[model samples]
Target chain A: MARLPPSSGPASPAPAPVACSPHGRFGPYGGRYVPETLVEPLEELTAAWLAARSDLAFQAELSDLLANYAGRPTPLYFARRWTQQAGGARVYLKREDLLHTGAHKINNCLGQALLARRMGKQRLIAETGAGQHGVATATVAALLGLECVVYMGREDMARQALNVARMRLLGAEVRGVAAGSQTLKDAINEAMRDWVTDCQRSHYLLGSALGPHPYPAMVREFHACIGREARAQILQAEGRLPAEVIACVGGGSNAIGIFSGFLADAGVRLTGVEAGGRGPQLGEHAARFAGGSPGVLQGTFSYILQDAAGQIAATHSVSAGLDYAAIGPEHAALRDEGRAEYVACGDADALAACRFLATTEGIIPALESAHAVAEARRRAPRHGADAAIIVNISGRGDKDMEILSRELGLGGAADSPVD
Target chain B: MPSDSRAHSSSPAATPAAAGFAPFFARARAAGRPALIPYITAGDPTLEASRAIALALAEAGADIIELGIPFSDPVADGPVIQRASERALRQGVTLEHVLALAAEIRRRSPVGLLLFGYVNPFLRLGWGRFAQAAAAAGVQGVLATDLIPEEAAEYRQALAQRGLEPVFLAAPTSPDARLAAIAAASRGFLYAVSRTGVTGAREQVPPGARDLVARIRRHTTLPIALGFGLSTATQVEEVGRFADGAVVGTALVAAVHAAVQRDGPGAAAPAAAKFLRSLRG
Candidate 1:
């Protein structure tokens, strides 16, 4: 526990760093490492971050964007049918997927767009996987009148065609990243390199809670407002917090957001579910928590799945969102603190959960989110009928249905095989 | 991060070598004088001179020595420190050699020694095991230039679990609250980066350093050690009036570089060691 300064009277000590920037290390990782061209923007970001956390105007504008633009206070729906189907445990979902841009990705993008505008930056650049964050960035960029460029792996652009179309329609210049492994990580590398080149006109709207200092901290702060509001709303609606809080850990922004609200509350069990591609034994899992050690990459140290020589190891997951070799640094610290437990769910399990939730709760979850669903399903039986689990329904699965169907041997078409 | 260049033993505090820290601090308290920390890159040339310089710094009245863990790029450093880093890198000094030299120093000196480097070396060595080894090697503390305290909590925890101090840098640019935050998480002295630029001696110290020192004092009772500037005894004396300690880096490295140039590899050690000892006066 951090030693809190004795408050003058009962006043709460200026809100202690929580999540991302908490302790100023993204969990215990994240720092600035881009080229000199980006230094001023980063310095501005650090300054803005210090100011925005306390500035009422910044908070109010962000709040307004969340309400009017992003459709936040997204429903906390009670999954009654799914609850009974999943071993009699009650389940509730904080439906972030229902928000604008079809996922919680907008929460961070909107805030970053606003920050970019405030900094007088006219161009917004980002890297995407499954194009969820790209679509979100493009959506916000259009809304904010900022020129947007999104770097996505060629493979991802091909697979997530609809999202690519959505981004183009939203006025973003989508670039197919051709370097490295040609995946999300590769896109990030390219985007960072671009930011290094044109940081003056562009702001790299990071999609998740990872990367160097201000980013991990900044992204987490924007996302944590989700948990803060959800926690209060859940308490008001359900009379108390849930026994267990679960979120899929792709870059870990959403999970960290929800989990930060409960860090000081020792009783709330936080579970972060990573992608368990085939299984742990297959050596292809995106479960950094399960199979990583402390290593430096992209300028910070955290639990990175790296080879003996410090090269980033390849990561795999059925969910493009979960296919990251390293998680956000704060998640790494949380894992170390024993405050949160990290688990993994495989391709079949996540897809099955998506199908199960669609049929039982009428909610088709993103593949990344279905991993949490799978985890909750596994734990619900052990905890019994009274257990309450809250899952951050981080995104909608509309984009993933094609891949899911093809992989599940249901054919790539929307029509059922029987039909 | 400088941490990548210095190969610290995983548990620096548990090491019998660090048994010297408590006594050193005790002695400082008795002497009513702040510690002087002089930083130098190891092996500006070959092995022999590096050894001589280490002994000279100890003999020159430096209460603690901060060893530079040289890497190819020292981003947080300015031209002087960068040149020094380049010199060391040119000589092909790996972190392992620095650690072995630190072990040699443990055998020779009673002064407190801290390894300063970027995070790469520690990450390469693996943090947990390195902590244990650093402690055993008699190294007292670690200040990783690039290991932001927020991202270093696990390593800090691991180091703490093993009783080593993960000394953190508190820069003039850091927010007041963050200064306190870093101070709170830090063990040993708080390294105050004198300005926004990298490690080097400046002709004029930043004007607000006294206020920064006062501000840090409010948040942490830990000794405030000023670095990134002080090169001479006069500069040290000036900073010593407001701060508890002084760190000199570029001047030491520049001296080593000059010595290497003048006397070749053979003369570098004595020349570098002699320059460091002069600062103690």
Candidate 2:
């Protein structure tokens, strides 16, 4: 070992001050791996969160906003027609699509936006994929009267044009990032750079549970209403818990939310369906657990689609929301511990399921949500006729109408599976 | 050679790493000026061109040369360095290639060598493997742009085994407690970001950088290198009055890029040499 320099004193300087951001792990998953510029802000945020989590005023204000503004307590509807056609298991659709802005993203948006305000940050910044989170964040920013900026990939901007317009209409500036693969991952990189530049005045309102510590758990708690409502509603509807709980995993927010409730129930199996864009190829899919290795990307250490050399790999998905390289660290932990089973549904299958759900139940599921539907269809037969599966329809299909029409070649109602 | 595995972890107290950077900084201090450290992404134009640029910068009075190991996603960098990484990656540059380049530079120059980039690729190459390879290549220190001190214990141990200094960045936003922790974890010079932003060239030296360096002084005596938005000889001279070193990353990378575009690959090394000499003068 190298000898100590004379100018430097003490072998150790008062212990590596435990005053920094928490390790916040999920079996070697979550931890702060950001630049030094963000450490103080993260510590400040953690302290503020610790205070807010206990304060009755903070709780009441957040509850009021979720109920009155964002439309919480979304319904759990039984998809009887679709279940009958799929065969074995009964299916219940947790209608997060029914929430304001037409996606479950509003749930976390409202919670974090309130937390950012409590931290005394006046400006809110976010990174988006399919623009669902951008819209949700923009909507809440408008509600709270905070300045909002959203970074989106130029490619995502072109694909998810309607949501882009919605974010703009909500008075948030949409910054187009054209770096790297020009997708969700690059958008996040750009957002972090933006956050690093002005972290004191701005709060990086990460849209998913996939970032550093507090975010994975914080975003999970914000959307826990999905699991809470589903748990009680399923018991009332089916007289018992679901045989299986399913949701799409991009950053794995919705899946983790619904899975959180059933996690304690050993009898209820939880399955997270990843977007298998084309197939199991490196650039073909965004299936982290399916094809990725554990590594650090953005802020969290988790399974990311990276090359052998460790450079972040290109990812493709029919659903822009699911076109990301990494999965949430918590999901990585759950998969490792075998508490939650993770699987993937190809683009063709996700699209087919979207068409199938729309034709059978008259519900146009977003392409992201359809991954869960497709997985449910594949596994439903194994669950038997008496068994029930709950698919969290994370968003409505309105935002994906253009892609659906283009992919399905116009009149999708008469498609083979829908036929 | 370190035959003992996890030997450093036996102590909760970290070994202050200023030892790793002492000799290099001593030489600069003897010269009565802050060390001129010019950063260039390895294989920016090509591996061969970068070797030429590194040698040229070292000859032009760079006390240390930071060879940026390009990452596909460089969140801590501005457009210039990001474009540098993009150009380097397009040349099929990897951590392995950068190590090889370091070995080549070590053969020709006695200048201080530091590997600068994100940590994922280093970890991808395996921490143990990277430590061995980098030390063998004559790289004295490594700075992971995103690996802060809070989560650097295991990383520090891995580097300490190979006697390679693990450099850490201290931001202006870091509290006193955080700065202390950073000082303890860091082995080489502490990279004090002049601004709370990504690396790039700006019009003026940030006012808070000197204060940040002062706070860092309270923690340890490691030489502080002011990074982020440093450009021009005037700013470098002004920074030299306070800190031990001034890093020119984005400005240097931009200069190399501009030279390559304006006069092709052959002009890159000479233009880089001229740029560093101008900063020192």
Candidate 3:
């Protein structure tokens, strides 16, 4: 309920190349806050990434894969009907949901998978919450013929059953993690444990732009294509840059990716939607920007929901994808610098948005992406009718079909109990 | 609480000197053996049982004790120690409880005591408050598994002010510069990870461990303790040949877990002590 600070005017020049911290810091927000055991591996990874960035062969191969295999340059569609419904700003949907894995996660997974092969790693491990990342990692691992394993919370596995099945069918072993809150954070812990035990032969394909150094930066670069394509596409369609850009923030990979493309445009406002499950009460939401404090979780220093004793607090959201206690480190830095504003969309608002989009635009959005839709809808009326708003539709809603059916009381008509 | 009258002393033992680890390493050097450091979660089964286990390990010739403050997410720990932490957390153990337990152990034992865990809990307690509490509890030092030297400036200052040594870890994969930084930042001893993995017992010490210790030796003369997969007496003796100490954690905690599974909480201390004795041989 406190007064929010005024947005700082865009500085003279664009922010120093997105997330270029020599020591892996995003203005005192990110650092390699990991055990000594991981320091060497992280350094080696950083060195390898630096080398690969300049190597034309590496870039060529990754580009080919992104274009031919994972389907690059996802469409930027103007949702004319939805824009009219909002009665103000023109709305454009950056259709990352149409990617091969039904989400934007494949972008980073494909890149990391290639890097792992370059590093001569024989196996890949990852953690997932809504199962999108797990499926993406599994798809890449299958294509590369590398042994793959994914850790998912037992609760998430049950909620996102379709994604679980997809991951398993792709030949990645799914390990159910039942520890702590049994969500993305716990799965990450289990994956880190696995990585530590098998660091010599295993690559931890971190899905989000979070965790220790190099990861926040690496994942963002891989997902940056979303922003790059959207920026160009929006310019061609509307003949100018959009007035605002929006995306949902879980671990903030998608938001960071899109934001990276437009960080220099001071005229455009950047907004990130967080999961406000029920309200502002503790344990009821995953709005780290609202309630979290600066602390270390997993490996990076970021805004994390924690109790007085510093123990991480459990988070809740209707969408499993956004049910995390921490956001990415770069997002934290962006918030600190007032370059981006984070708002919360509760479960009801997101669900309504999801339903409205399905009916109006004939597009179904992942519950996570629906949060961004809800926020864009709220802000659209405040802007001029000619103003344009671009929202990153990060994933399709296939994985949430069952949950949606149950929540909407539309279950029990699809299949028999035996099947 | 145990009926041991010494544990009830209104005035706790005097806080150890800033160079608390010096005497232990010197004693081990004179005795022609590596210092044996045993680790256990502070409230594994119960706070009282953890206290009894620490006392028992000290009695069985442990040179130092690393009490793990149970955390919800311990990324550096393998399943053995991870389960130990989970059990402790399930019993409502917190950083406050661990500090109080350290005071109890300090009242009855002379072995060096080091608080070990992740950084968040300590940060949650606030650096200054946690440092003061640790000093008052007679804790000799602290080693946060995830607090790298790069981000350890404030933490190092807090610990130094309280005379609590700040222990840092040096990994097998460390480059020369990082090795030097770790060595320079370390106070009590430098923990040399035997492999590029989390903590657990292994049959054979990773071949890289010896070289890691040698690399650390180039940086400083600080006592180096090799750990992360040392479970057997043979492995302990192997590390003793080169390093200043051998840390045995998962194996000892596993031993306690097995005993507790078979004989309930009362058997934890005896089982841990027996395991420590076996390692000493």
Off by over 4 Å in 2: A1-22, A411-419, B1-19
What stretches of model 3 exceed 4 Å from their correct place?
Answer: A1-18, A414-419, B1-13
**Model 1 Cα displacement at A87 (Å)?**
3.2
Please give the DockQ score of every candidate, comma-separated: 0.06, 0.70, 0.74
Query: Over the stretch A1-419, how does candidate 2's per-residue lDDT look in tens digits?
Result: 11111211133223222211357788888898899998888878777776766666777777777777766777788888977777888989999898899999998898888899998899999999999999999998999899999999999999999999999999999999999888999999999999999998999999998887778888887788788888888888888899999999999999998998888899999999999999999999999998999899998899999999999999999999999999998899899989899999999999999999998999999999999989988888888889888999999999999989998887546546642
Clashes of each: 35, 1, 0
Global lDDT of each candidate: 0.75, 0.87, 0.88
User: Better model by lDDT, 2 or 3?
Assistant: 3
Summarize candidate 3's per-residue lDDT along A254-333 as a digit string, tens digits: 99999988988998899999999998988999999998999999999999998887888889999998999999999998
**Top-down TM-score ranking:** 2, 3, 1
Docking level for model 1: incorrect
Clashing pairs in 3: none
lDDT by residue (tens digit), candidate 1, B207-272: 878888888898987778888777887777778678888888888878877777876776665765
Off by over 4 Å in 1: A1-23, A26-28, A31-39, A281-283, A412-419, B1-122, B126-281
Winner on DockQ (1 vs 2) = 2
